[model samples]
Target: MAEQDGAIYDRLTRVPERDWDKNAGLDALLNGAREPFVLRGFVADWPLVQAGQRSAADARRYLLDHARDRPFTVSIGPPGHDGRLFYDADMAMNFRTGTGKLGDIFAGIEASEAQDDPRTVYLGSIDIPAHFDGLDEANPIDLGDRDPLHSVWIGTRTRIAAHNDFPDNLACCAAGRRRFTLFPPSQFRNLYLGPIDNTPAGRAVSMVDFDAPDLAAHPGFVAAMAEAQTVELDPGDAIFIPSMWWHHVEGLAPFNILVNYWWRDTPAWLGQPQEALNHAILAIRDLAPEDKAIWREMFDHYVFANDGRVTDHIPPAARSVLAPLTSESAGRLRAFLLRALNR
Candidate 1:
């Protein structure tokens, strides 16, 4: 909506923001980007954006009208939370989740906005087709050939900690303004990640508080801040977050809604790397030091640093699982793991 400078958040660099590229292929740029970027007013013509521009009430009505008769899972934070959804001192989640309709959440946000200390009413990651049915077709962003799983995030004045997603994201500021502070995948070490298996959300988030980071407590964050890129997007603008890029998001307005499309560039049949990571923890984390060294070399040879000649000692046909994985072979491998893990 307006030109912005990332002078805040320790003077983080601003993400590259510009109008959509029509000459160079849009699909390729979004799917293959190694960095994050803002597509300014990319979804300006969306009905939701137009409705939101008119009034908050108009936006709320538009969503309710499009929404199906399905109960939504809502996350509610206590008053004075400053809309940060996170764990308490005991490592328990600070907020509580419950079932509610969209109207309830809208009312709660409106009510919270009026209060001295505001409660966080966040409706996060509801699948569009399941919840809103025809919203995607109605307010569409042509993703070219990509068939994505669209999800809607509606909330008010929320702080979502820095986290990465497996799939690349196209986050549209459908209604209100949003500020995203991003870190590259290489800055993973500096993010101060929490327990992987035990997270408030599915993804592990950085423990550092963006509002007031305790630098001494999290010394690594100082380094992270050096590499950070921040951007503020107004209604109708969108941002593309590449897979594994860390982002801490903020819902800036009293009544806010974001529609994001997520899709992996890989084949749908491919399993998540997280599952393999979890399995490795169970089987390998505490292995004898000497044995661990052996496994590390083996992983590097077969997976990480393999140049297709690691199995040259064996005949090509005899390589079995060492061969390049086709869809059928991947299925077989997955099935084998299920049986082995079950035993």
Candidate 2:
């Protein structure tokens, strides 16, 4: 429990190890979670996690033995930069990045006492199959019909600022440990979002520094953190983060490695809702306030509510655009939107 000096009543709800299994219980929670919760022994048996139980060096060797000769991009920052990677005053990215051999980078990590001095040097997302051949065989988890998009993240004592991902993520702490402070998407307004087009860690991150809060500068972050749920993970534990949930990640050990499986709940035919949101910002953001309110109601009726009664008045045969979206209808709608945008 990473609580304040004498604070009581941890914000996160923790469920014990024996309560949930990986199949139905885990799937149900991932599908319909309203708040973040921790499953105690979700991945305690992974070989990587087992190696980590011995020592951090042992875990590093295990992963390195499986890796290929592929080069990986690394993020580097000076010691005492306090672990948080972000944009500096000049709007330049705080951390420097370069590509190098996986073995060479790991050697550097092993040689340095990163926890004592604290430099940010890590690989963000290395494709598991591409870099570590047959690694998935060592640690298998069922994602069912959806073949997950898997990646490996290895780094030193570093912190990734609050950010949201597009797909649902299952992050397994295979080596070292981590603490995740998560907030719901509804707190987007209070999170102090950065530039959408340019980002440090491949996504729009929050400007607020949770480790050292500048309360005067970002007053809204107080509200956001108040709603946050913090979960500390040891090696072998895993967390399922639903899509669009904002999370700030901290690597709690000198050398850290995590494997993540990303998948969408919806079928492949459905387009990314974030793309539609970007288009909406372009088309509807500057409208008159009254017109904006009317459009909001229209959107609620069409997209949010899913109220079949509103469209029951129209005959099914005549309901072309408003019909239930089957694969064929979705394809037609996509084509129609493309044509409209092209004009």
- Per-candidate Cα lDDT values, in order, are 0.85, 0.80
Best by TM-score: 1
Model 1 residue 90 CA deviation (Å) reads 0.6
Question: Total clashes, candidate 1?
Answer: 0
lDDT of 2 at 334: 96
Encode model 2's per-residue lDDT on 1-343: one tens digit a residue.
Answer: 2323214225443322335766654565666554556666677888888888898888888887888887888889888776678898887898899999878887887777745785678789888998887788988887656668999888888788899998888888888888888888999888999987678977889988766678798899878877777777888788878789999888887888888988886777888877887898888989999999999998998888958866798988888768777788889999999999999
| lDDT of candidate 2 at residue 301, scale 0 to 100 | 89
RMSD of each: 2.8, 3.2
